[model samples]
Target: MTIPKELEKILEITKEQNTWRRKETLNLIASENVMSPVAESVYMSDYMSRYAEGKPYKRFYQGTKYVDEIETLTMDLMNQVTSSKFCDMRPISGTVANAAVFRVLANPGDKALIAPVQAGAHVSHTRFGTLGALGIEHIELPFDKENINVDVDKSIKMIEEVKPKFVVMGGSLYLFPHPAKELSPHIHAVGAKLVYDAAHVYGLIAGKAWSNPLDDGADFLNVSTHKTFPGPQGGAIFSNNEDYYKPVSRTIFPWFVSNHHLHRLPATAVTALEMREFGEEYASQIVRNAKKLAESLASLGFKVVGEHLGYTKSHQVAVDVRPQGGGAKAAKTLEEANIIVNKNLLPYDGPEAVSNPSGLRIGVQEMTRFGMKEGEMEEIASLFKKVLIDGKEPSQIKREVMEMRKGYLSVKYTFQDGEWEQKFSSKVIPMII
Candidate 1:
């Protein structure tokens, strides 16, 4: 059968993205990862044409037999990866997943105990987040700057006083294992459900590299597939308590989300199963690389966040750049040299605005994926010192930055295979340059 020109044009457009993939630079943002090849294939597979709403194997629309198998594998893989009793692998993203959770759990104006956005809380749990516009009240819990973990005593006291309906246990930045076991009992004492947002550390938890909130007394868990977990952009919610199954699914289906994205579902399910196989080695190395990088940056006089033991036990590290200039300027300077990192707010900022804050967040996942290790982190830290601390010209550092990046060419993905390296031959659109 001859292919239609319209479908041919769409394929050409996809080919353009394939062609341009290699020119893109570093993705150092904390909440991102390179998905596996099987995940990538299923993502762009013919399943994209189907619409399988409702639940797996049971669809309102027709032609869902194969798609049903995909969804079943996705949910089962999710269950295996996190050891959860139940899993939902379709919220579009982590932010919207939290929105679904709030829809099921809270009413308008219901108080939510959460750490502030400026204090490393994910955007979904703060005033500027999805829940904020939904009329949920937010109560900020103070954190300990020294340890970079929750001040459990202070948080519990505040929970006792506010008695919020929900308590958010996870933050965007993690330097140590959360005291979930200690905090969960307190939240329950005040009749609050602990909703653990594990978007940043889901893979680590899957690999047993970090604390498992579900086992530690979290009533519900929300996570993203991209960060830590090597999957496409999507969100999920799971619960051991059977009561949440109905309300959570109802809110996600008819209330908040209409039809889940079928294209993302198959890829996500495939990636979830891949994580079950290769996630331990990858997740462990991510945390180890993070620690090494943090230590190296600190040794270079960069004032990296956290203190002893590299100030982190996960896949992220933050450096205080305000003494040099500030997070915004430093980020822009680094970007000029083809290095990418984001400006973030530190808890001790006292009263700094969220935009263009004082701290810089660095991630080790992508660099680790590129096969760079502790020595490379040290060399890169020196380069950072040259630009941010020593005030050298960015142009001088740019050459070295390019060389370092070039040296760490694409390594073989244990799970993704060689599809990522296959460059597209045809470009629908001409090169921009």
Candidate 2:
């Protein structure tokens, strides 16, 4: 049978995106990452078509024995990686993980404390998103803009005054670690649970490139498996306290998830095993590249944030791009040059600045996974200067970007070396019958 024209066009577009994103471009998006070839291969398994509604070895459906074993292995690996006593691999996304916890811990009309949006709280933690959906009232934690963290003393006072049911730490725009150790006692004294949203930095934590919230007094750690973790896209909930395990697990199913995405189990297991072996090295390089990139950008006259704190301690680096036509315009320009980045809200920006905010949030994890290091970070910063500061045409800079990308195509920190090219080559090209 002949392939339909529209279907062929779809295949053509997929091919273009795969080539452009995976091969030709420098992906610097903080919330994005590439799965290793082995993980990706397992991600495309027959498990995608099946469902296992409950915990391992116990399910609402049949033919889930293998699924049970795989999930159990995945859970064990997750616990080993995070050093937590309990883990739930069921939440489909980080937001779903947050929702599950919220439903389990708080009732409607309960007050919750969260880092302010400007300070990096994800929307899911706000009253406008998941928290609001659960009918929880969320108050912003006091932020110390100069220090770029939660104002510990002020937040403690607010916690006592409001007595929220939960206090959420960690965020999407995070640059430094929150004061989890400092606030945990105060939060618990007020009968509030400490929830750390490690969605953006869980991989960094696993790699030992960042602090583990579970070790720092967080009662619950919620995370997305992708991003800096370099795994399949999914979410996991972890806690050192086993007392809260049953309630959290029960809430994940029958309330938030049913099938729970079986395909990601083996892929997640592969990633966990990879992290156990290579996470430290990968994470160390990621932070070094981020700091080097920030310094290079700052030297080139870009307004890199956190200058007072030595730029950054994680894979993320934010730049105030208002000088170069604001973040939205600058991000679009960089995208045209094949240097992918995202517009972001800075601490000084108003809530309304989200659409065309003052900053660009760049992460080196994906590029670091592609084997680009500190020197490559310098090259990337130079490219940014050319397009944004020197007023060069994006098309002109795109040639250099592609040339720079050519040498860094292979993914590192995984079992298979140079296997992504072989695995994806045929899939990207349209199949003609």
Q: Candidate 2's residue-wise lDDT over 181-246, tens digit each?
A: 999999999888999999999988998988899888899999999999999899999998887768
lDDT tens digits by residue: candidate 1, 1-433: 9999999999999887543333334557787777654566557766666676788766788888887887887788889889999888768788877888877778888999886554467877877776687889888786776667778889888989999888886778666666779889988998888888888888889878886899999988888888888778888998898897668876787666667777888677767666677778778888888887888888888888777645788888988888878889999998876678888887677545567778888887877766777788788788888888888888878778766676665633454344423543232222233
lDDT of 1: 0.77
Clash count list over all predictions: 1, 0
Error of 1 at 27 (Å): 2.9
Computed on alpha carbons, the lDDT of every model, listed in order, comes to 0.77, 0.91
Best by lDDT: 2
TM-score per candidate? 0.88, 0.96
In model 1, which runs have C-alpha deviations exceeding 4 angstroms?
1-24, 350-352, 411-413, 416-433
